[model samples]
Target: MKNRLKVLRAERDWTQAQLASALDVSRQTINAIEKGKFDPSLPLAFKAARLFKMSIEDIFQDEVSEEI
Candidate 1:
């Protein structure tokens, strides 16, 4: 999976720690997600979408979808 998490956080001037706090995750988790080294759980993805007022599809993209 790929995500625009870093861009979204940058747009809001939010640090990884800040994003982690808001998402109830660790800063490393945020970093991992931003770097595409980790994928968030469905619940976490929904929480992030709710926080950003975006759909999960808006934030996270399925790499397989791009292949089509």
Candidate 2:
């Protein structure tokens, strides 16, 4: 999945460690998610969206030619 996580975090001036702590995950997990090397679980995804005050669709989307 494609995500705006890094961009959003940047906008908030948050480091991976801070975001991870807020979301209760490891910094490595936040890094993995931002790098597109991992997709977060459903609950984690919701937590991420909540952290940014956005909807899930506002944070993640498909880059391929598939309907989201």
Candidate 3:
């Protein structure tokens, strides 16, 4: 799956560490997510969406292989 965490965070002028702090995760976790080296769990996804005031679909898209 692909995500827009970094872009959204950048739009808000937040550092990776800031985003992680807001989400109660480690900085490395945010960096990993931003780099597409890790995928968040459902709860984390919901938290990110809530923090950005966006819907989950707005930030995350289905894998191309899973798209119709």
Candidate 4:
């Protein structure tokens, strides 16, 4: 998935570590998420949405096509 995590973090002047701390995740996890190398679990996604006061759809986007 492609997410606006980096942009959102930048808008708040937050570092990866800071975001990680806020989300109760490792900095590497934040980095991986930002880099699109990893996707967060549903619970984690909800936590992030709550933290950002945005819906999960506003943050993360599904990049895969639905076409079979």
Candidate 5:
């Protein structure tokens, strides 16, 4: 999965720690999500969508894979 988390955070002038605090997660968790190292749970995703006032698709995207 690919996400616009970093861009969104940057647009709001929020640090990873600040975002983590808003989402009730660890700073490392926010970093991992921004780096695409982790996928958020459904509840977490919903929380993010609500926080940003964006739909899930607006924030996260499914990257096409070449593997058939």
Candidate 6:
């Protein structure tokens, strides 16, 4: 999955560590999510959506290909 986490964080001028603190996760976890190396759990996603006041769909998307 792809996410708007980096953009959202930047818009708020929040460092990865700051965001991690707010989300109760480690900085590494936020970094991984921003880099698309890890996908957050459902509860985590919900927490993020609530934090950002956006729907989960607004934050994450399927990285589909158009090869077909």
TM-score versus the correct structure, for each prediction: 0.98, 0.91, 0.91, 0.93, 0.92, 0.92
Tell me the number of clashing residue pairs for each predicted model: 0, 0, 0, 0, 0, 0
Better of 1 and 5 by TM-score: 1
Alpha-carbon lDDT, every model: 0.98, 0.93, 0.92, 0.95, 0.94, 0.95
* Tens digit per residue, CA lDDT, model 5, 1-68: 99999999999999999999999999999999999999999899999999999999899887874233
lDDT, model 5, position 22: 99
Model 6 whole-model lDDT (C-alpha atoms): 0.95
Position 14, candidate 6: lDDT: 99
Candidate 1 residues 1-68, lDDT tens each?
Answer: 99999999999999999999999999999999999999999999999999999999999999998999
Top model number, lDDT: 1
Q: List candidate 4 stretches off by more than 4 Å.
A: 66-68
lDDT of 5: 0.94
Would you list the rank order by TM-score, best first? 1, 4, 6, 5, 3, 2
Name the runs in model 5 displaced over 4 angstroms.
Answer: 65-68
Top-TM-score candidate index? 1
User: Compared to the true structure, candidate 5 yields what TM-score?
Assistant: 0.92
Clashing pairs in 6: none
Q: If the candidates were sorted by their lDDT against the true structure, best first, what order would they fall in? A: 1, 6, 4, 5, 2, 3
Model 3: per-residue Cα lDDT over 1-68, one tens digit each: 88999899989999998999999999999999888889999999999999999999999887885686
Cα lDDT over the full model 2: 0.93
Candidate 3 positional error at 33, Å: 0.6
Worst 10-residue lDDT window for candidate 2 reads 59-68
- Tens-digit lDDT string for candidate 2 (1-67): 9999999999999999999999999999999999999999999999998989999989998777356
